[model samples]
Target: MMKWACHRPLALVLGMAGLAFGAPGAEATESGASLYLLGSGGPGTAVMPPLEGLYFDKMVWVYDGSAEANRRIPVNGNITLGLDTTIVADFTTLLAVPSTNFLGGTLAVGVTMPLGAPIIDAEGLLTGPAGGTTLTGSLHDSALTTGDPVVLTQLGWQADKLHIQLSTMTNVPIGHYRESGLANLSLHRWAVDGSLALSWHDPESGWDISAKAGYTANGDNRDSGYDSGDEIHIEGAIEKALSPKFSLGIQGYYQKQVSDDRGMLGPFRGEVVAVGATAATTVMMAGVPATFRGRIMEEIDTTNRLEGTSFWLDFTVPIHMNMPAG
Candidate 1:
């Protein structure tokens, strides 16, 4: 028997969602897209799987957002006003956990590949050479393409009812991108993020609390001559197990840029706050245990970015498990 059967189902969902990135217009960074998805690390952030195995996770995300006419957004070496955008992306991730331990903790490695369709409708403006003349027009573009892949590594430690994890993720810019397209699915820049997560779970009381904080350092987009600044993100969740197989929770996140973007007309920092509800459950598929989770979030406040709502659906299953020899 696997050790996860005796533990809470939350352990099965850990580290999977946090590896997903790249949804344009859903959050904010350079060109109205970021390498770190805002609501990706909501619940079960610090827990590690009890059994060594290979796991597969699939996530479906949708977002619809818009910026007011008063704000300006830099995109494709041009500026846009009153940006309205919709994004739909799917992420497939694979996680591998070995039977070995490193530095007194469990080590895990994973990768996420994302495909996205982004639509943008906005008022466009282009300036001539040496700021000589200006052109204004309406722009609408849409594309279905692959986004950047993210690779991650994490170390997890457990102490009684508390769990902690340290993780690093890197974005590889081999996805589909066009320098002059408004509906590009990739950021076309290299970026790295480091995060720390903590979780307190009381099995007897069926209560779980988790929080994660991360920092992202972005590289310049050579195609657009844009240097995106660093960013900070914080996410938290609180949940109660209704039964051994089901749980419900509330989750929220805050994201803000810590520095200014270069090659833009003026200040181009972005910030947003969002809150939502999440639910998860465990089920059996083909005699193997599987987990399903869902979340919906609405942005309550935003600055220099789009304000919108997002929906997420995730499914995870262990493809192979290494049972301990008795």
Candidate 2:
């Protein structure tokens, strides 16, 4: 019997990291809503059911050094560390539908909470009024965001050797938008985002292929001086099954800045190239099957890609309450 009871929180952590990393790109508008929410939910990804809907997965995860950029500041020479950290938690519920066709689908609705902030640490840059030598200090109120509750809907289509999917999400600022906790940053507004994905399976060739794409738009920023812009990311992954219940996969994505304005804030722009791998397995508990999954992603700039890399891990186990005893 498998109990992924403790791994659910791991998925939330990874989702939060995505929210942080996706904020700085040249195309990221930094407009209305919170940028943190955008990162938690990747592009073109929806609530997908695992293992024929016997059970759905709920997950949470956290990792550092995922995507951090160090740059020189003009005034003091303090190195600005733009870091991304994320958290997400959601449940999957299977809908009622007759199984007449081998290729089937499911719908999942849940909330994604993302929180991110900027931490400025100074190096040997210039001098401040207090000292004639190098200055060191951290910026206050630099990190601002919310991990709002996003309503998600996903459609999955699977067959003998092929599967495809699409998903969409809308963020509702339900947490303490002005007060910060658990997630760090604070927010006071809402937003919306959408994504789509397609995957193929070939057991004969011992390989699996998938492609994904997505977009986001901020609604309203309560703090002012910042706006969220629309963004896009496309990725493909290949998988090789090691056993009936185990597999290893590698995925890569290209994220582009689609919007021009900085929303209400000044213009800051860049693009990203993401590469990563995943390991997954299936387990049975109480005569019911569940899935355990993990993933890590490394991101770099495409044009003048940054030097540092960001990484995170995700674990998921679906919970299906309505499935009849099999």
Candidate 3:
């Protein structure tokens, strides 16, 4: 018989994973539709001493194929010959600041390098002239590139229910734009995202509730004929612990368009509904504590303009600061 060690499920760990794969739709533009905050401020709310730490997050995205259409011309232009695959790498460094009174807040900023490639490798699809033959492979090939920087200011409030946090972030357009590849689809822009969440301690209740909302406003992507300026997103989640070291969480989100540059496109109204689940556990390496997490999400395409449906899978691992002295 094999012996198994039991571990207690932490609501904070499961909530953080829920936010990871919540929705890739147009949220508060932290990093092209993804949230910026890395981990939860559950127990790690204290202002740490100035020291260097390495934090990394990788997102592997594989998009389903769809047909490209022109609204005005009323024609199915071409099949999206390749998938839109994105791999983002973020390297984070934490800096400690002075704590005000009993509440502690930290200013941690990081830079992200987004790399992607269109699965279409064939060339010479759309070369020239009106209609340009194949609009699928006309543009340049997708490759690695640096895309905008994200700065995070997290405010941790020592509350009664749970440690509360208010994080503000910004996104700058410093990337390229390709017609058919991983290039950015929007122009230079900036946004602010805010979230309010709590981790409960009631073992009998066995459930946690968290709600977060975000807003975004910026320039337009005229070259691609898609206007993206004003947007709003609101989300709510319910999480429950199934057992020690394992749990399940569900989340739903809504996006509303505030304004429209519309550029040269058709109906600009867009909204998305997302449902997600997550699982987490602890993995000890060399006597050090590290948390491993996984999430699966499905998004409904309420708006007919964009892709009808999409799915995502993400993993997060949190590194404990208490390492053995060398």
What are the TM-scores, per candidate, against the unseen true structure? 0.90, 0.65, 0.61
lDDT of 3 by residue, 1-326 (tens): 00011111111211101111111212111112332322222222222212223333344434332323221111111222222223333222222223333344333334434443322222223322343453544333444444445454545553544434455555555555444443332223444445454334333555555655555554544344334445566665555657655556666666555664333223344455555665545455555333444444455653422232333333333332323389
Tens digit per residue, CA lDDT, model 1, 1-326 = 12232122322222211212112222245665666777777666787777788878888888887776655667767766667788887888788887537788888888888787888887755655532167688888888888778887878988998989898888888888867688876778888889898988777787888898999898888887778788898999998878878888998999888987777554457777899998887788888877788889998977767778888888878788787898
Give the clashing residue pairs of candidate 3, or none: none
Name the top TM-score candidate.
Answer: 1
RMSD of each: 3.9, 7.3, 8.2
lDDT of 2 by residue, 1-326 (tens): 13222111113212222323223332233311223322233311322444333333344433343223443212111122343333333323222222323345655445455444533222222333322245434333334444445455556676665556566666565644433221333333455556666656565555666666676565545553344445566667776778767777777777555664333223454466767777666666666555566666666554322333344434444444444468
- Residue 8 CA displacement from its true place in model 2, Å: 15
**Candidate 1: which stretches are off by over 4 Å?**
1-28, 127-132
State the displacement of the C-alpha of residue 183, model 3, in Å, after optimal TM-score superposition. 4.3
Candidate order by decreasing lDDT:
1, 2, 3
Over the full model, what C-alpha lDDT does candidate 3 score relative to the true structure? 0.36
